[model samples]
Target: MFYSFIFILFFFNQVKTKSIVSINREANKIIKYVNNIPNNTWKAGFNFKSKQLKEIENIMGVLPINEKYTQSLEDLGFAIHHNSNNILDKDFNEIEVLPENFDASKQWSKCKSILSVKNQSNCGSCWALSTASVFSDRICIATNGSIDNNLSGEYLLSCCTGSCGRGCNGGHPEKAWKFIINNGICTGGDYGSNEGCQPYSIAPSAVELSFENTADTPECYHTCTNPHYTTPLQNDLYFASKVYTVKPKMKPIMYEIYKNGPVVAAMKTYEDFFHYKSGIYQYKTGSSKGDHAIKLIGWGEENGMLYWLAVNTWGTLWGMDGIFKIKRGSNECGIESRISGGLPKL
Candidate 1:
């Protein structure tokens, strides 16, 4: 009866994606937001016994994920492949294609600004993640890397103009951008004290402040040399290629997250994501492919075992100090199928 899909909003009175409460408050409790992973439920049960886990381990050669049936862990967020070795389909190392040599001189003013995630679990905040990333990038563009800053994640989660709120479940990237372009975003330090997003007032008013702009994107002619750079986003480099342009209707927001860093993103949780403690995953019967709102920095093959170098918002407790590599290929997480684009556009 472990309907793993029974998330916080579906099972509880919670309106998805409200930010986490403080440590001393009940608002932030993962249980308050979501339901438990029922041991008897099929989604929770998975019909897999220790023997099966062992078999999966033997056959797949990795540990399977286990949960305390807790709400936070109930999502079974994502799973790495059991035998992950070949993740990238096409390999192109564009060293000289980078925008800049990743030097401080080339720093975008908004590079220092960061939007905080602030633990909006189970609310499907992919929208917020996308919006925040855009605003954060814009801050860099506006500042030209002169200001090492951090934006407010709580603000984006709670505000971000129109394209967000009520949790992480819904919103659009363009809407978020409209708000930022119309109204200057507050710095993370102004909200909390870090460069990431922070809690603010009149959460929804910012959405009303959203407006339009006519600034054209400068011709993307700048170039540099950095072996870490990838090109065209897709086309066999990184996961997949993402193309952007500032057309009459499409105002492509130009910003760089990492020259080449593996990004750890939250995925739509499903039955298979559980039993991932062993660092391997098997294809499941659902469309649980990664819908990464965030991008990783880079990836590497260790002894033929490829691991995605990713940055996380989990505060360094889970995975390697808030960073871990997922199984690359072999149908583990189907990451090969879920390619996010982040290449140098020189």
Candidate 2:
């Protein structure tokens, strides 16, 4: 009896080394978390202490109500700020944007059912993709409602001008337009994966956006480059362009073609992004990695505050379907603050 009692006591006294907290969020506001800690230890929970929580709450006492969110992306482990609140309006036109012609879009017309960011499992390539997208959208709209101008992000990654513009670090969107114009764009399939680019360039047009390398050819992303259907006009980026609607849309000039997807924005870092829970934010700790990229698709205002709807390449399991509302023309995002979003002619 004495030996059994001693063993029981020791078992009960064992120390807990670790715990896991699983956070499940639904619809950007519903969060259900389960703490898997040692039976007696409340270990698997918030990283902040109770005092810290109270302090944080106090610091954010004036913040907007965002109970729907339980995660706070205080940083990408870097710099960024608080929460979200916005509406999805279908008041825009119904035209899909892509490069000229009926090749790729036509080929995959039956199979590709309007892909959203929720379905795309992209990594940190949000910048390249978004840059490509914006260019496409701008061109499509400029061309009297055309929808076939999808250039390849893979192509940009390989043959873009300057150094390392196409890596995990966010690529320059405004610069991307210039590069595309000089080089002309390529089909997404022309390049493969995050590595390896084999472009099949087409004859240079009067309105070429950017071009591939000398070794590579420029193919259409959607594979629809019929001369009769192809528009000679290329998409270019404009600096300081006014926000036309409630949300200034990210012009699609690249590989992916979604009405609502991620746009390349300047966040402060290149690490694990913590979930953001607060409704309003300014900035935070960490380096300006310039490595991480994102997408901006929609936007509007809440309580007279401006916000832009955007997408992160992380996963649909994050943000609002992998999307969030950022302060439009705010200093937090490097765009509006940096150079006043000035884009030079290509």
Highest TM-score: give the candidate number: 2
Residue range 122-216, candidate 1, lDDT tens digits:
33344444334434443344445554444334344455523232334343332333344333344332222322223322122121121122111
lDDT: which candidate is best?
2
Per-residue accuracy of model 2 over 21-92 as CA lDDT, tens digit each: 111111111111212212311112122222222112111101111323112211112112210112233422
lDDT of each: 0.31, 0.33
| TM-score against truth, every candidate | 0.39, 0.42
Model 1 bad stretches (over 4 Å)? 1-118, 121-123, 130-145, 160-167, 172-184, 189-266, 271-292, 329-346
User: How many Å off is the CA of 167 in candidate 1?
Assistant: 4.5
lDDT of 2: 0.33
User: Lowest summed lDDT over 10 consecutive residues: which window, candidate 1?
Assistant: 245-254
Model 1 accuracy (lDDT, Cα): 0.31
Off by over 4 Å in 2: 1-124, 161-166, 189-264, 269-273, 277-291, 338-346
